[model samples]
Target: MSDGRLPTRRRTVGWIVAVIVMLLLFAIGWVMVRGFGALSELQNVRHSVAQLHKAIDERAVDRADRIAPRIAQHTELAGDLTSDPIWRGFEFVPWLGQNFTAIREIAAIAGDAVDDAVTPIVALAADVDLTTLGLSGSRIDLVPLPKLADPLSGAASALAAADARARLIDLDGTLSLIADAVGETRSMIEDAASTVGALHGAATLLPGMLGSSEPRTYVIAVQNNAELRSHGGAAAAFIQVSAAGGTISVVRAASGLDVPALTEPLELDDAVLVLYGDGPWRIPRDMTSVPDFAAAGSLIAQRWQSQFGTAVDGVIAVDIDTMRHVLTATDAVQFDAFTATSDSITTVLTNDMPQAIPDPAAQDIAFSRAAQAVLGAALSSEEPSSLLAALSDAARDDRIRIWSAHEEEQDLLAASSLGGALPHDDDHDVHVGVLLNDRTGAPLDAYAAATITTAFGVCDGTPATQIRVTWTSAVPEEVAASAVAPEGGAPGDLRTLIAIYGPQGASARGGLTTTLDRRPVVQQDITIAPGESGTATATFTGAGSSDPLTRLHHTPMLEDPEILRADIDCG
Candidate 1:
């Protein structure tokens, strides 16, 4: 009985062992299948990545092929304009002559290139199906065959899911990079197109005006009055010649005035000269009524004697209001679209009115609205031919008060009175000679003053001095010295030293008083040749200092007017 029981127990143990072995084998087989599947999936993912890279490279090549020719053409056109002789003499002409057709072609080509490059990228960005790209059944072979049936199998599955998520994230990043490239390309193309279009438009009109046959010459006479000593007591006389065939020549004539200190007068050999001065003088608001303002105009004529050989052919004087009206009429004011503060826009708009518009806020808003309307109209217009005309008409109809005197008026009166006092031959050039004579019949000692107001209507605080009495001679050297005042308080005072303020100021003092300092100062000076009259000048220097009075101080006031007293004629 004992032997039979032992044999049965052994058989039961053998059966238990056999069942455990079969279970182990089955687990191992399942793990091998999953491992192989994961390897195949990884290989497929790698192939997709390669294909994406290849597509990117192909797109880049295709874009380059389309863009290179346009870029080359643009470069070539720029180079041609820069080197062209007709354009070089006057830069605006070549700019105006720029081929709009070529520019448009380049812009179109660039636009097309950008569009083509972005098309595929945009598609790829939109085509991605995030759900499909996720790996629900994907697995990684992290567990050994023996450990396939471990309780941590759930953790291993989670790791595999994490790896699949990582791959999808990588694909998303690649797509994002492609999308950015496409966007950059599109932006670049747009910018290029805008730049080209602007260049083309600017060039078109600039050259014609610059090279026009109309004479661009201007002659100005400046005076200084010692009594009304503000900005060197200066006044300005300007003559602009717009006629096609008019000839202007300035000669240095000898008149009784000092030479060495005054230097030589600049001879305007067919060139336009603009002169400005200060004085206790009057200017007529209307040129048609010359007699009404003759006394004031006489002062202008007197000032011209020092700088010009004769009376200028034409004169047109427009004050601050007129200037503002012209600018506004031309629609030249511009505003920044981005980052332009309301305060800044308001300031510009309000400050540019004819007489400081009563309600500044309302005026600024109105101006802005009007400007918008005009701009909108211009943009909407099918043809821009009338744009400039409209602007000019606005300026003309703005009722800007101006003073004008022309040679034609003077010539007509002279012709009617003289009948034949002046030669009538058309070929003979008309000369407007100015003769300087003192009341006592002695050499005249002329005192003059010139001033320059900058684009922003700021006057320089310095005064130029031309002293001594002798004959008027062409002294070109005096131009610089006469344009600005000496650094020292007195130009002739031997003891008075001229000092220059530098970027780092340990003032530089010089013994030479006649030499101009050219520093930023509102110049005012009284030139007295012992008992003779002299000239003064003021220039606007847009410089600022820490002192409030000196901060951006552009207006130079003439402090003394007794230098030009009628009873104190030096002659």
Candidate 2:
């Protein structure tokens, strides 16, 4: 045992053990170095991507082109650094393994999102004169749309595949730091996918809907926010518009009151009938109170055909919020009494003009004029792209909804936010929904204020969720309640239909109200007086979500709603 010189076999074994340890140490050292490099590369990729977005947003195509290669380089480097045999081997270490695997997979997805999905779309956008791509004043260009279908579809598919992959990654079990990173990554990918998917849908659907192939007609409902409805507000006026090739002209305009109630109501989903009752089925103005824009569009279309014997190709509904958004991109629109900018458009439409022009017929004419003036301003806007951006923004906020009558195109529309169809697809986010519908028969909703918040029962990993709405009637005592009294309403009284949709597949138990789309929905009717307040809350027992955040998919109001959460015990 003490001999300085050993036997040949023992010496060979000693040499083998020494070499193995050296290799192991070298492998560990290599991984450590690569890890640092990969992190740096990823950081560079993030920075480059941000720069790329800025360039794209600024419409600096040349700058975006120059930035592309940097992103590609870093994404490739990050992927290569994380996917080597050594790195892959570390992914077998149980919980530790998932972190490594998630990192590696996210790196690949990042590469795919930028290089394959975003770059192609950006390139496609650059290939065309985007300044006039969507709308220029009153005209819509359909000439360049068909060419975008294939590439846009491919980009959407790639991003959608990437999003699906990201959603499958379990973040709850991962380290907090890594989980946050992954969640952010997932959100970015999802947003990209939704945007590209919508673009793809537009490219495929707009041709026919815009009457590129043949003449078409559509009904446009501009909602009046003074009288609130589920989709936005009471339909104030309707415009029958016809399109051929690229030009759209107003065929006719009619007040919502002109159309008589349906002697026979359009068939509604039993759930809708139970909750909305016969109000929607009875009155033309209340037809839009149904939340499903697709259904509401169809109902309006049917009502129009019955009343005017006109068959329309599609339907569009917009509120003052949409107009207010577009005013930011267009020139100031002049009303009878004042100039309306983005900040004052809502008041000008719903409050000032109606109060200034008290004659019902005269007020309707002014309403129609104001709408057309806004359109004329938008068509002549110096920055046409800005109008498109505004419209996209409004659509995302649920202030504008379009529904196609064509079967092929409608399928795509029903699946996207472009149509404002109530979510039919199963989603992962915890959903809390609230709807504020005016029943006071007055324009007093414009003077109302509401605060919506989320509450948890016990906060010990609470499964029960509560949605609280504290609504206040802010109408002043001196102001007239309404110019044209469609029905009797007190200036001091605010009556509303408030519905709180709990989490998906959850029940309110004792708080059970009604069911919509086979999902539990709680609703209540309340009346509040001026300077007074009312509160509505719904508690659902089975509400749960893997996501730390809850999604409040409520009706878009005149004021941007803030969704707040309160934890009873954990706070």
Candidate 3:
């Protein structure tokens, strides 16, 4: 009777074990199905959002309007899948627990971004007549644009929150591939947030800057980067432009050389005196030497006033490449020796025109004529949106910069990258600056290229950092000699004062030309004949950081802007 009872207990235990196994299998199957469904929905959300962005970029209002609702729907679906009951059942499951948590986090991030930025953006899009805005002339109506400020501001706030949330996410360990995808989604959200922030700022500021109140006067200094300098390049030419009642007019135009010398002694900074000497101030002829645009613009305004007896409200500086970008809106203009089209204007102005007339005095004539022709064609352009787009593109590339004496106007420009001021940032973990002041008188920088690298670490309980700056000229030895001189100076010899602004509180130690006001300067002399690369390195003790972000604020040189970012781990 006892043996029979034991067999009965064993049979009962077997039935219980089989039931538990069956339930586990069912739960696993449900998790897998739910996870895959969430993933699919997330992918759909991504696709829909991408399509919406494309529609907005292409100004396809109807398509964007249609896609916006779909984006919201897909995002909501993704959120539902991530927060499904299956995830709750799998919360205690090994490996899948982390994945489920990450998925939910990603879904929430996406949904929040869509709600914060996309919702307001779509609503704003619906309210505005994009096609009409695009087709309008150079002048934009500021009255209706101010109404967009609230929505844009809301979108900006949402994006800021998204970016902050993204930084807090730990998308690693089990199911890291999915985690990586989630990380990418966070990056996209950050980018969208930045766009919305910019739109918000523009909405809030554009009305006043575009002459909603009174007329504004600006001096446009056209920099020829062939003779690259700190701020941009030598102001090769300048145009006085005015905006009144939302209309822009070219008041006057002349070569930089045409602006007469300043008689009075101009106050100068130590950096300007050390790098440029008394040339820019005494003569007001060379605007390139001073890296500070505010200072340079002040001097330029003085000269402008001296010449024209009219005060300028601000100064806008742009290089030759930016001019070519502006020309994209217009048809080609026939110059003396060649046609000035958007594609050819840079070459014609920098190479062909320079080479055609070697006389320094005669160069301005060509530049003035080319400038006038390009400006006329650009202003007369029927595609005002295209012109603005081209200008915006150039501005993003750092080819265009603006400095305003008016505090109110400058407040707006200061918030933008176009504000050509050396950043006084202390909150950043690391600040690295590579400022090049061309020693070569010619447009040799057009052929010169640079590479910058920084290594950081902690040693003996103190931070240590090292910066390496390498410069090379691609100009052939034979042609380099001829290309060396610009205006009137040494030929083939590329002499540059490379100022390396190291991390804050870090002293530069090594072979340095001179240390002026904490900035270590390295003088590089590269002749066209050698084709050899010049290298400069400086080690700074006590500059290491726990946070390994390396921020580079450099004078825009001839390099892909993306390639200049050097972010590496700190030891």
* 346-383: candidate 1 lDDT, tens digit per residue: 23432333123434233334443433333333334332
lDDT of 3 by residue, 1-571 (tens): 3554557788899999999999889878877787788777777877888888777767677898888778778778777876767677676677667778777777788888887778678767766743334225556777787788887888888887877676556554657667766777777786676566656766776666657798888888877776767766777788888887667789888886788666654776766676567777866547656765667777788778878899888888877787788778778887566788877787787677767887755776677667777777777788776776677667666787777777876776676566766654355335567777776666657767778777666545556566667777666565555654633334565666667766555555555555444555554434433365787666566443323455567776644432342443333
For residues 71-120, could you state the per-residue lDDT of candidate 2 as single tens digits? 88887998999999989987787777787777788888888887777678
Q: So what's the TM-score on candidate 2?
A: 0.81
Pairs clashing in candidate 2?
A: 137-379
**Which residue runs does candidate 3 get wrong by more than 4 Å?**
1-46, 57-62, 73-111, 130-135, 160-195, 261-265, 280-285, 424-430, 459-461, 483-490, 509-530, 541-546, 561-571
Off by over 4 Å in 1: 1-243, 246-291, 308-311, 329-571
How many pairs of residues collide in model 1? 50
Taking all chains together, each candidate's TM-score versus the true structure is: 0.18, 0.81, 0.79
- Name the best candidate (by lDDT): 2
Question: Which portions of model 2 miss their true places by more than 4 Å?
Answer: 1-47, 53-62, 76-109, 161-191, 358-365, 425-430, 455-462, 480-490, 543-550, 568-571
Q: Return whichever of 2 and 3 wins on TM-score.
A: 2
